[model samples]
Structure formats: C-alpha cells, structure tokens
Target: MSLSDKIKSNPSFKKIAHWLMIPTGQHRPRLWIRMIVNPFKHKRGKNSIIRYRTRLDVFPYNHFDLGERSVIEDFSTINNGVGDVFIGDRTIIGMGNVVIGPVKIGNDVMFAQNVAVSGLNHGYKDVTTPPSVQKVETAQITIGDNVWIGANSVITAGVTLGKHVIIGGGSVVTKSIPDYSVAVGNPAKVVKKYNFETNNWEKA
Candidate 1:
C-alpha cells in the first residue's frame, strides 16, 4: 500500500499526524508537516502552502486537487460538495475567500481577499416553492491561466474566465469573459482588450 493509504488505515498514526499539525498561529509549521497532515485533505502537489485556519470541505478528500507551489491563505474555505476542484500550478487563493466546485482554476491564477467563486446556483423558478427548499443547479466554472481576480469580487455559477483576464474589485461576474480582457463593475463588462496589432491594451 502507498504511504497515504497506510496512514489512512492506521488510526494511531493519523491521530499523531493530526496532533503535530495543530496550528499555534505564532509560526507556520514545516512544509513536511503540512504534507503529512494535509488538513485540507486534498491530493496536494509539492511545495504548496496552506496557511492556518484554511478549510477544505471535500467529504472523500479525493475530490480536490491542488497543483505545485500553490498557496491557500488563512481563513479560506474550499468546498467540493458533490463535485471536484482542480487548481493548477502556482495559484494563490487569498485570505477569507470561498471557492465552491466543480471549478477548474488554471496555472498562475491569483485571487485577492474576500473573492467568492461558486459553481452551484439555487433554483428559484417556482414561486410557490420556498427558496430554501428549492433544488440547486450545478455548473462547471473554468478559469484560465494567468488570471487575476480583484478583491471583493463574486464569480457566480456558469461563468468562465479566459487567460490573462483581469477582474476589478467589487465586480460581479455573471457571464463568460474573453481572453486578454479587463472587466469590471456589476455583471462585469469588458472595459479593455489587448490589441495585438498595437502591442497594447485598448478600450473595448
């Protein structure tokens, strides 16, 4: 059996491992300790840093995958309920962010504080049915490489962001954003697009 498999089956070892990972908040634990404890319970890659108090709510633990050198800051929550989350290499999930899958985040993506990304939406089509009791609709969210999402932004279900995209702070993304665009405001609109012919970014 693999080391992870063995560790999972051994209650005593698992307890010991968890104990060593108890965060003190004064100093971060070693990389190896994080690797062993894997508090997020995801299949993590090498050199990734998950700061103190970050939570990953993937029941089976195998539903989440984080790439190499990625960082999930403190107080962030990643939920993969009934879905999967795949984060590519060198991504940074800032503090106080909440990401709900099925969501695919490509390489070198950066999200500022308080950014919310969700792949599920509550269905309210039936007015007779209470909102709380309404069925939920699920969709896949795809974020391409080298994207930067500003602080306090909300990326709703079914939204896809292409590569080299930049979202302004406080923006609400409700649609697909094309590549090399700068989007901002509620129901985010593209304000700028890269002009390859001019070798610059120009007004959209």
Candidate 2:
C-alpha cells in the first residue's frame, strides 16, 4: 500500500506521529524523534532540523525531499500539493516562510524570514466561475546553488533563479534571474551584476 493509504488505514498512528512533533520551544526535536515522526512524509537526510511550531502539509508527504543539514525555522510551512519539492543540502529556510512545490532549490540556499515561494497559481480565466473553483496552473520553480533570498520576498511560479543570485528584501520575483545578479524591488529587476574581471559586483 502507498504511504498515504497506510496512514489512512491507521488514523491513530498518524495522530501519534503528530503528537510526537509538538513543539517545546527550546530547541529542535532530536533527529531520532523526527525520523520516527516523519511529519514531512518523506525521507530526510541527516541533521535535518525543523524548529518549534513549524507546520508541514501532510497530503503530499512522499513528494517532499530535504537534503542533509537543512534547517527550517519556526512557523514555516512546506506544502507539496501533489508536486515535488526538493531542498538541497545546507539550505536554511528562515522563520515563517512558505514553500510550495513543484520547486527545486539547490545547495547552500538561504531564504530570509517570511519568504514565500510557490509554483502553482490559481486560474481565473472564466469570469462566470468562482476563482477558487477555477483550475490550478502549475509550473516548476528552480533556484540554483548559493542563492540568498531576502526577507519578505515572493517567488512566483515558473521563475528560475540562477547560481549566486541575491534578491533584496520585499522583492517580488516574477521572472527568471541570471547567475551572479543582484535583484530587488517589486517585479524584481537586476540592480547589480558580478564582474568576473574585477571580482566585484557592479551596477547593471
């Protein structure tokens, strides 16, 4: 049987698992506790840390993949929503962040507090129908290695961020950003680019 089927078959087991993950507010639960509880519904690598009060969506558990030593801080929510979510090694998802898949984030990524990343958008093509009832449109969001997303940033669907990119605080990323670029503002625009010859970041 599928993992979801198993969990459905034994509701008590699911309840017990959630109970074990209750936050203590002191520190992250032990690795063993996380392993046993397995709230994300997927296998996570060593030293994975989910801080106190963080919430993970349960439906698409098997679709989530967290690499080694990744830390998701308090109040963060990761929702798979029938799509794949991959967080690479040593990535830090700061407090109150919401990450929705299909999204692939590479190694050493840092997302500041309250960052929102999502790959699915609600469609509102038919004026007669309620927006909520409309079909969902989905596309993959890919963030390459060494990306640092500042606080309160929103990364929308189908956006690709290249390696060594930096996004300023409160920015809204609606399109792909090139490697070694620093982007800021609503509908984020490249403000700086890394100069290979000078080894400095220069205004774009």
Candidate 3:
C-alpha cells in the first residue's frame, strides 16, 4: 500500500498526522504546514497561475495537481482534504468557484463564475450523530476535454461530463452526461447532442 493508504488504515497514525497538519478543531492547515511542507508535496505545473485571492485549503495527505497553463481565478476555493484534485492543461477555473476533490478536470475546459463542483458528500444516516462529525462519503467527478460549465452550476458527486460537453447556467448536474452533449436545469438533463453524421447539434 502507498504511504497515504497506510496512514489512513492506521487509526493512531491518522490521528497523529491529522493533529500535525491541522490545528485543533480548525479546518485550515497550520501556517508551518502550509508554508513548509505543502510546497514540497503539492504539484503545480509550469505556467499555472493561482490568483492571489484564491483559497487553497489543500494538505499533503491528498494529492493536488494543477496542469500547465491552467488558471484558477480570484475568489475561488479548492479543497482536497477528502480526496485528490487534478486539473489538466490550459483549463480556466473562473472566479468564485468551489471545487472539492476527488475531481479530475480535463484540458481546455472552461468554467464561468460561481460554479461549484464537489465530489465529497457527508453521511447523515445515523440519527444520533451530527452530520458534520459523521463519516464522509466520496465519489470521483470526471470532466472530459473541452467541457464548458456555466455560472452558478453545481456538479454533484459521481457525475461525469464526457468530452466536449456543455453544462448550462444555474444547472445542478446529478447524473453523468455523454460526449458532445449539452445539459441544463436542476438535476441537469441532456437537451442537445452533437450528431457525428451531420456535424450538427440536434435536440435530444
């Protein structure tokens, strides 16, 4: 098993590691951990630009990668505490976006302002326990090449957007969308698809 896997499987190790990385009852990482340790563990591709106002709540335990020429705009928040976050080359993550991993975004993707893409979900099945402290569930969210996500959209856990797909503004994507398709609305539905034969976008 990998070092991360081993640390996770061992309760004692996890507790100690968690304490070292994060301050008691705090969500943000310690200053030393962020300045000293994270620079070595996290990977930032060449030419990637992370805006000064962006908040990266990432730790060394989980992987975080930003591809070459990718840009994370101001007021955006990226957290990889629950899982890994991977962004491919030349992608633009717009302002005020919230991205929680395990999310893999492909190359040349475009995201408008205020988009929220999360792969982590809290488990509140137990009545006696508060959801905040309960075990969290995670699923990977995959976005293929050239996908475009509009403003105020939410891409929920386990959803996949195939290559060249487009998500409309204010949509909540709860399901997977196929390649070359356009999806919109809450619990987003596929409304148009590119037909290879005609090279045209036809209503679905």
Candidate 4:
C-alpha cells in the first residue's frame, strides 16, 4: 500500500506518532499547540516558521535545502515523499496551500491560499489502461525570482515558471510560463504583458 493508504489504515498509529512528537518543557501558547505538535522529521531549514494553525500532512525535507526567512502559514498541508522541496529566501507559502516536492522555489515568491504545487503525475501510455491505474511519473518544478502565484492555483510537474510571472488566482498551470507575463484561469493563459507606465519596470 502507498504511504497515504497506510496513514488512513492506521489512524491510531498516526495519533501515536503525533503524541510522540511533543517537545518536553517547551512553552507554546494554547492556541498554537496543535500546530506545533507534529512536523515532518526530515524538515529542516534556517528561520523557517510554520505558524500556530498550520498542518503539514506528511511532508519530507532536504536539510541542505534552506528556507531562509520563509513562512508557511496556517492550514497548509505538505504531503508525503515526493522529494525535496527547496523554498528560497523571503518566500511566503500562504495559508491552505499544499506542496508535494522535488520543487525548487526562488526568492521573493508568494503562493497564496489553497495553492497546490505537485511534482508528480500519473502515466497512461497503454490505450486499454486507465490513467488512474498507471504508474506515477515524477518531475521537478522550478519557480524563478519575484514570481507571484495567486490563490487557488495548481502547478503541475515538469513546469518552470519564469521571473516576475504573475499567475492569477484559481489558475491551473500545466506547462511552463514565460517571464513578466500575467497568466490566469484553468490551463493558465497569458492575458497581459507587464507594462511599466510609471517607470517601475523598464523595457529590456
């Protein structure tokens, strides 16, 4: 069975695991206890703050991959072993987001609420085979500098988001995006080019 199936099948074990993770003699405010109880064992980074109300489901981390000054806010779920997720400096993974890794996110990036960043997909090459029954394919997701991923967006595997790309809320980014474009909707499309009318961004 998959890891997810194992978690479902042994709810008691899961509860026990949470109970075991409680740090002794650490004074956390009552409001923040549940959120601080259990975090993925492999998660490590400098100054990575997961707030009081957040929930990271079963995520793993690469210790060498740093999350410098990053904030994973409340109600987010980072799922079990896909691979390592590297969040760069000054990144904000907002509330209610889910990230399954093998993803390298760049500096100053913001992922809004309910955003999903996944690095795995199901394969279905055989005509007679259903996609759900097929083996899973894995890839890496790379986000460039100064990108803004809006609320409720889903970024699939093997995709690279260029610098300064603004993905609108509720977008489904299946493919790669170019630099400085504003994309929106399911199967996100570039709707407008970034025009600097106020000398904020100069044309290249």
Q: Name the 10 consecutive residues with the lowest summed lDDT in model 4.
A: 25-34
Q: What local lDDT score does residue 187 receive in model 2, on the 0 to 100 scale?
A: 87
Kindly report which residue pairs in candidate 4 clash with one another.
Answer: none
Which one wins on TM-score?
3
Query: Which sections of candidate 2 miss by over 4 Å?
Result: 1-41, 60-62
Count of clashing pairs, candidate 1 = 0
RMSD of each: 7.9, 6.8, 1.5, 8.7
Residue-level lDDT tens digits of model 3 in 1-204? 998789989999999989988998988788997789988999999999999999989988789999999999999999999989999999999999999999999999999999999999999999999999999999999999999999999999999999999999999999999999999999899999999999999999
* Superior candidate under TM-score, 1 versus 2: 2
Number of the candidate with higher lDDT, 2 or 4: 2
* Candidate 4 global TM-score: 0.68
lDDT of 4: 0.74
lDDT of 2 by residue, 1-204 (tens): 987678757989876654554443322344554555455457687998978788766333337788999999999988775468899999999999999889999999999999999998988989999987688998999999999999999999999999999999999999999999999999899999999999999999
lDDT, residue 46, model 4: 77
| Model 1 misplaced regions, further than 4 Å | 1-41
Which runs in model 3 stand beyond 4 Å of their true positions?
A: 1-9
- Measured by lDDT, the strongest candidate is 3
- Number of the candidate with higher TM-score, 3 or 4: 3
